[model samples]
Target: MNIKITGSGSYIPNRIVANADFAQHVFLDEKGAPLTYSNEVVADKFRQITGIDERRYVESDLVTSDIAFFAAQRAIEDANIDPETLDYIIFAHNFGNVKAGAIQGDLVPSLAARVKHSLRIKNPKCVAYDILFGCPGWLEGVIQAQSYIKSGMAKRCLVIGAETLSRVVDPHDRDSMIYSDGAGASIIEGTDDEGGILAHETASYTYDEAYLLFFGNSYNKDHDEDIRYIKMYGRKIYEFALNRVPQAMKECLETSGIDIKDVTKILIHQANEKMDEAIVNRFYKLHDMVTPERVMPMSIHKLGNSSVATIPTLYDLMLKGQLDDQVLTKGDIVLFASVGAGMNINAIVYKI
Candidate 1:
């Protein structure tokens, strides 16, 4: 039997934050000194590199679990499956529910449990849990669900990736412009039909790259050291991903036994526009061919980077015919890949 993603859903928050919104804000360097460039110059340079004109944010009353539930509810409906039949509910996220103005993440009960509770799934057989594998968390959750199906432990599963990064960003750090809130979910199950997941690969580069992306005190320096926000060495991460993600994708496609020519689409993590272009360009170079036109679909131009939610949200939008000129038909072979905070990378080859 093949493992297939039967249905999918995503929640892109309604609050749109444009690049121009940062005009009056103070952006500081790590040394607590102000950047020499004016706010317009800083935001413009950021757009040139990251290609983010705006991003979404959750309303003041919402949290990560709230959005996760919204996405899960839609996935269940899309699959037209009864919630009680689900054998597992796997949720992926970095920071848990960080309330408005809160400095801490609330993770007493797993986000999976909270979502299952919100979905009102009454079956006692449904096991729920959460995974923290950085930006690749949702794809990693899909990999885990495949394991359960292959091991006879589960036949149907709900995998979700969601985050409310707006609550965890440092206003003084320019990198804060790259994060936003969103959620995406899928229903995966064992199937006798043709299309399904074919192969997957993962890697961890923890020697020195572990701190490439980490939590740190605000750039303002006046913020308490005990109170930290998401921080990263942007240059280091771009270099690390360039050197690793493309190779990982090649190995995964090879393991699936699909020729490079048969691959139809590439759904990569939406971290930066320039970085993704470089990685895809390098992947084609490795295969000794030029990149194909319209093979990759992107949401970062408007949605920014929602970590684990990027790929799923992009896929959802594609299926709904929201992305112009990007389409996937039956028998299409697609590659799903991401690189993020563990300094981690993962890729999967799937037949649609």
Candidate 2:
């Protein structure tokens, strides 16, 4: 049995936040006093390091499920499938919808359930749930959907990755510059054709590296107060991705019996442009070859990193020819890879 991604859609917030926007808010020192740093300096440094000029943030009233609902509706329309026919709604997100004016995150209904509700899906048989796999959540959801289709248990599945990182990020922290809000969705269905997901690989290194990137939900000695925000050791994560991601991609390609040269595109997570480029370069080096310049498409410059939504959003943009000089055709081989907060890494090979 084969599973094919029949349709795809993505939604990014309308508000565009430039690097200079950070200057308006004041960051506090340990003494609860303002730490002075010019917005120009901060913005220049951010652009130099992350290659992000701007990113989008949802309106104050919007939640994770809200963006996901928009994306899912577009995907279902694209797939030309009835909402009632969907067997599963697999939503992936690290933080569920954070209510307006609320500091803490909430997931009482689960993002998947909320999306189903908003879609007005009345079929009780359509199971809905959520997956928390850091940035790999979206790919992991697809992998699970593949299992259901292969087992003859499901005919169609809606896999969505959505996040409002702006809600979870600490505006006082520099890491917040790399976070954004968006959602992407795909409709996967059982297919007799051979063109679809061919192979996949996933791994976790949660022992020591688990602390490398974490949410601060406790008192911070450095700040002399309680803090709950996304925190990360940038150097550690950069080193981890440079070392681990390429190997994971190579393993998936080898397992699928596909040659590196035959891959049409490499749609990696839009975390960092430089890191993603290096990972692809390193993957090709493993096969004693040079990386192709046009193979990897990127949107990090405009979208930043929306956690699990990165890859799916990029995939959808490419599918619709919204990306520069990129297009997919029948029988094209593509690779998808991501590494993030879980210290989790995943890769997948698919035929378009």
Best by TM-score: 1
Backbone clash pairs for candidate 2 read none
TM-score of each: 0.99, 0.94
Compose the digit string of candidate 1's lDDT tens values, residues 177-265: 99999999999999998989999999998999988889999999888989989999999999899999999999999999999999999
Report the CA-based lDDT of candidate 1 relative to the real structure. Answer: 0.93
Global lDDT of each candidate: 0.93, 0.89
- Superposing every Cα of model 2 onto the true structure, what RMSD results? 2.2
- Tens-place lDDT per residue, model 2, 28-78, is 543445557676777787787789999999999899999999999999999
- Model 2: residues with Cα > 4 Å off, grouped in runs: 27-37, 217-227
Q: After superposition, how far is residue 123 of candidate 1 from its true place, in Å?
A: 1.2
